[model samples]
Target: MGRSKLDVGEIYMAESKIDARIYSEEEYLALDSDLDVKYEYFDGRVIAMAGAARKHVSITGQAVTALNNQLRDTPCEAGSSDLRVQLEGTRNYLYPDVVVWCEESRWADKADNTLLTPLVLIEVLSASTGHRDGSYKLEIYKQISGLMDYLIVSQNRVYIE
Candidate 1:
């Protein structure tokens, strides 16, 4: 069978309005291939997450470095924002700011990275995405049995959850 079509829904946030969209994973990937910003796909719905600010990138960098150092002598490997973790029985994929996975051989170890089971996942939050990171994404990430921890780092302060 073929994939479903994309549709727009009326989304209201107080005085602000946004268009909620639903598209198949394949359709989203086809669109994402040409876009610059990373997006998250959940059950045929697409949400374009905000890009990391300078401070957000810095914190993510440091976190990835620390995780990499910690796994230097082990089979686990650490990664940053360019990597994606497929979740929900491979129905969805998200590009977390940082990820650590034990299955190194399966990963290509490149910039556009992929991990089967990330023991740890980190997200540097922006103003537009802080709430989703804390609630929606948190709940979904927890569903992965291999995910041990999901860390959320604030862009404005030295806060890490």
Candidate 2:
């Protein structure tokens, strides 16, 4: 099946007004071949992800580096934003800014790119995504059984939680 294109907003907002149609998980996965674009699956709706800003990218990189260094010689390891995390048996798939897995890694697929378990997930918030990160994404990430820390860092400020 071909990917569905909807004329949503600028695609930079976290919560977009996609009223065209709700797509199935299979249809959403079929569009994954487009390397330049990323999509987040929420129930039956697919939301297009926008490219990160300069400060957001820098903060994510620094967090990954610092987390890796802090987790060195331990069981946990840091993964970049490309890592896809599944919400266990649910139909949700998201890309966190930085992730740390301490126990055995569980791959959602055979390719080992999708993760099913992670100990810590960090999201570097942007102006357009702050609300979603604090609300929708927060509720979803909390469903993870092994998640101990969920830090939402502000890219333009020094606040984090």
The lDDT per prediction is 0.68, 0.78
lDDT of 2 by residue, 46-77 (tens): 77778898888989999999999999999889
**Stretches > 4 Å off in candidate 1:** 1-21, 104-114
**Per-residue C-alpha lDDT of model 1 across residues 8-76, encoded as one tens digit per residue:** 111212112222666877787776565577666666656666666788788888998988888898988
For candidate 1, list the clashing residue pairs, or say none: none
TM-score of each: 0.76, 0.85
What overall lDDT, based on C-alpha atoms, would model 1 receive against the true structure? 0.68
